[model samples]
Target: MERHCVFVTIFVLILHLVQAQNQTGFISVDCGLSPPESPYNAPQTGLTYTSDTGLINTGKTGRIAKDFEPFVDKPALTMRYFPDGIRNCYNLNVTRDTNYLIKATFVYGNYDGLNVDPNFDLYLGPNLWTTICLVKTGISIPFINVLELRPLKKNVYATQSGSLKYLFRMYVSNSSRRIRSVKMGQNHGSTQLNSTHEP
Candidate 1:
């Protein structure tokens, strides 16, 4: 009987991903903003920056330091810039056996002044999420990370595996490297960052 209707359609899609994994999945994206607005007096509450509308692949939007006070009040997300290619994505609408609290932020206000400080390679769909080395000490050096997602299916492809971590964070820096302040806890269980180097 067609293998019992393919095992009853994979058990009704894993029982609709366990009833949509207990209803509570908030996704905030402010990657490379430009004409994409939603964050100015939001301080931070289910953050939103849907420029290019849930981008999945497309690039070329750079801006750096223009009265930039570390993104003032989150100036629509660090003034704006998404300079990386070949695998740039932002298609978040997850819920397939869910468990998420994914927060991704990046700011490199050197913007191409060639002060250069880049290292990018973060993905969740094709799974290899984490490799952002932006420690250029001229100012904008905020590369926040706090991802805890355990989705086994239903679209997971965030690929940026090369660019040599932006020339290895603009040829490495060591002024005693110190700027680590990212505290996000409430554990969703399933977070791993075996230190691929970050400061």
Candidate 2:
């Protein structure tokens, strides 16, 4: 009986070690969330996300309109908006020369009830990463919903200088039967090349 108990403890320890290794180099942030509602696991992705309160000093917290709440994931329901300041940035601690995949999600669900899209710029360490023009109508505001970072393998996607910006990703089957595309910044705009696929 004692030997059996020892074996069970060893199995449990191995399981805990595997789980910790899987979550080692990952950071997920849900902007605009406070203490009580901060740390929660996303229902869709099954990933734990923490509040971004300590990472950024600027920006005001706001929730999306009631009508659009059901259309987005839990992380995208609230946002951090920057109305003032020429440049607002989030501070993250990352390894010096490690490659990381950074993803920022933006969902303009009429959070301000203005029914107008926002336009702004995104920068990465003093470099202009991209111009975030939600619509062509010319609006002015900056907001973010979710931000995630994952460490990548050293030999994968090696660049000569600067960093890589994520735009979009697609998966194609071997038979070219179906294609699935996921565009960053727009979480509700995924497209799949199947009749029954829903966005």
Candidate 3:
């Protein structure tokens, strides 16, 4: 019994260590999840996501329509919609001059039952980042599904002035199997690329 207890304790400690390693320098938010339902690990990415509850004071939580839920990942099935304010912002604390990658994802699965698309602007602090214009189908307000921040290496994608906005990312490789991992830098993160080509 003593040996078994020692083994169990070691297992628990290792699990906690792994979880902490995965979350280092990463902040993931599931926009519309309720407080009790948050801090869940996404099955697709194995990333822990918390509710965007205390990040902002405005916006209301909502789930996508049942018909569209099956087509999206768990993070995209729910969203936070902002209908009252001209602009809604989420406050995050970061170290000064540290490079970071911010990612926001939106999936308009007709959450409001209006069947209409939404149009809005996204901003990074006081600067305009981009305008989100969903394809016209019906009519509704702006919504967001997931938001994430990952700290990057100091020299990766550095610019003299002003922040950088993500436009698109593409990976090219000649490997037949899916590109398992692409190392960003010496101690930076890695990305997985999927491909379906005869090679």
Best by lDDT: 2
For model 1, state the Cα shift of residue 177 in Å. 18
> Which 10 successive residues of model 1 have the least lDDT summed?
162-171
lDDT of all predictions: 0.40, 0.67, 0.66
Q: Candidate 3, which ten residues in sequence have the lowest lDDT sum?
A: 186-195
Every candidate's CA RMSD: 16.1, 9.4, 10.2
**Candidate 2, residue 17: lDDT:** 70
Residue 6 of model 1: what lDDT?
100
Q: What is the TM-score of each candidate against the true structure?
A: 0.26, 0.67, 0.66
Each model's total of backbone clashes:
6, 0, 2
Ranking by lDDT: 2, 3, 1
lDDT of 1 at 112: 61
**Model 1: CA > 4 A from native:** 15-27, 34-102, 105-199
Candidate 2 Cα lDDT to native? 0.67
